[model samples]
Target: MTAPNRPNAPRWLPLGAAPTTQRRVFCFPHAGASAAVYAPWRGIAGDRLAICPVQPPGRAERFREKAFTSVDALVDELVADIGDQFTGDYAFFGHSMGALVAFEVTRKLRAIGAQPPKHLFVSGRAAPQLPDTRKQLRALPTPQLIAELKVLGGMPDAVINEPELLELFVPLFRADLTVNEAYAHRAEDPLPIPLTAFGGHGDPRADDDELKAWGELTADRFALHTYPGGHFYLEKKAGELIDIFAAELAG
Candidate 1:
């Protein structure tokens, strides 16, 4: 693996001529979100790194396709889609349901003996191994499920108010929640990579201590950062998060 900070040219070269690490960060979105959610990040990231959002089926351009409900199956399909493309230094950032998907995808990459992420950044989720005690709300009636999502935040009031919008949003959310609620965690040795976990101060799902549980999954380095917001804190903390990514990927 290429160290992010390892100079690509001789040290004697002029500083401007020295090549810096330019990594590709694959991002996964929260439940019921499309790859479009990360579109704004390109401008934020600038040229320091590339932001590639993983778009699973059943959303956006893939709206006609069925979404994957099984976490393991989703990981398998994503890895297959990735193939051998991770030959270059890369990283991962995921939030909420996406956080879990990103972590599982990283593990699947390791299983295939493929290139691993230089660093793993996960947000809005607790450690995967933790038993999910949250009530099963995926199968709830549409009104109840949307209500629950409202309590969790992230869904705009406009989306909730429009019956036409709910027709499109509801099924995708059910599939995503099913993915989260049906997941079964299997024990594996900790990964040999740094992991930085992010959380919202007011997020009932993943508090400071819950976020810290991610440390147990990495033997290299572990960090936990909390922001002041609810479950959708990243919507407000994007700048700070990208800034950290820039600094971390530099080395």
Candidate 2:
């Protein structure tokens, strides 16, 4: 596979997946995460659903491109870029900050009168209208920002131990932080698609209560699922996560 040319340009790396069935599930990464995070889901997601992981810039092969600093701009590009993947039935699954981005993308699709998703799976995030617990990290000093990343989970010890590696992540993390901090959720009509909210049972940022509130964002079916672990619980329970997603999309 060819490496990505830029940080902001999406790495449309397919997981060697062939959607043998009807529904296809598109996956989005969390803050500072790349499409490769969902690579583990490819085999188990079943042939019925194509688990295409959306790669945001500034990580993985996209290391050279400038990461998106604004949420609106990122969504705009993604909505336009994902046009080719809209075939057959489709759904969206996003984790942490990606959840909000997926929701916003859904809104943009709706506004443009595009085909809506069959289902929306939002994991590790609060409802759009909920209060933001964490403050913006872009304004923090570099050291402080790294500390915040530690608290968020998912950073490897090797990266922290190596100054060169950590330096590579600083800009990407900052851009992701800026995207999250600057996002403003304007009130809009509820979506017609069903929503399945997933979260870590022990995630400090969002609990079952906060996740359940995501039900209010949609007019269709709503369900909240909890897995064992912290903010990055999906990594620990990847098999179970794929199982849940497959079942939802199959239905």
Candidate 3:
């Protein structure tokens, strides 16, 4: 399949992926997360697939740059900045806020006549079109935000305990929450690629029916998998998830 003409992968994109893999999965982290979140997948994914973690600005190596507060702007930049990587056989895996970002990015890619992902794996989030019924926490003050994060099991105690790190992390994550909480879902035809939704049984964000709703946005195929933990369940189930990735992307 022909993709849009763009420069080769930029320096900001890491090259630590499996060299011999036949397919690539660009993994997007949840809100306030960095590319480091997916680092362990490199080893678990083995050689069948390459794990490419997406690093948004204001996180990790790109911490100096400002992060986008609008989903449209982020999607637009992602398509233009990293659209080159989608040229080959590739798919997208995103969790929580990342799931929403990845879904929108795929739509943008298609709108530009770029080669679409082979499959889309969404985790820890509801389908984009669904109305969020949860209380708004994006505008919470520092202490309250920390409380919400702890309640949602978003950050580790180690990171939360470090005052210096919390100072840096809070605003970046709040910006991402702004992107998430303010997202306006425009109606569009379902994408013609297989979609798989995963969630923790105890996840407060998206439950079974909400997770199942991801099928509505995909005309090709749909699947759902429920794990035993909360929003951050994948942290403990990475090895199992990697096995599933191998099975699904064998083509």
Candidate with the greatest lDDT versus the true structure: 3
TM-score of each: 0.90, 0.90, 0.93
Q: Residue 75, candidate 1: how far off, in angstroms?
A: 1.0
Better of 1 and 2 by lDDT: 1
Query: lDDT scores for all predictions?
Result: 0.82, 0.79, 0.84
Q: Write the per-residue lDDT of candidate 1 for residues 1-251, one digit (tens) a residue.
A: 33233232211111112121457777888899888788888789888877777777778777888998999998887666554445566788999899999899889889889888889999998788998887788999988998899999988889999999999989999999889889999999999989999999889778787899999999999988999998988898888999888788888
Candidate 3 local accuracy as lDDT? 0.84
Candidate 1 TM-score, true structure as reference = 0.90
Q: After superposition, how far is residue 55 of candidate 1 from its true place, in Å?
A: 0.6
Report the C-alpha displacement of residue 237, candidate 3, in angstroms.
1.1
Candidate 2 RMSD computed on C-alpha atoms after optimal superposition onto the true structure: 3.9
Report how far residue 150 has shifted in candidate 1, in Å. 0.7
By TM-score, is 2 or 3 better? Answer: 3
Q: Per-residue CA lDDT of candidate 3, range 137-243, in tens?
A: 78888899899899889697888999999999988989999989999999999999999898998889899989999999999989899999989899999888877
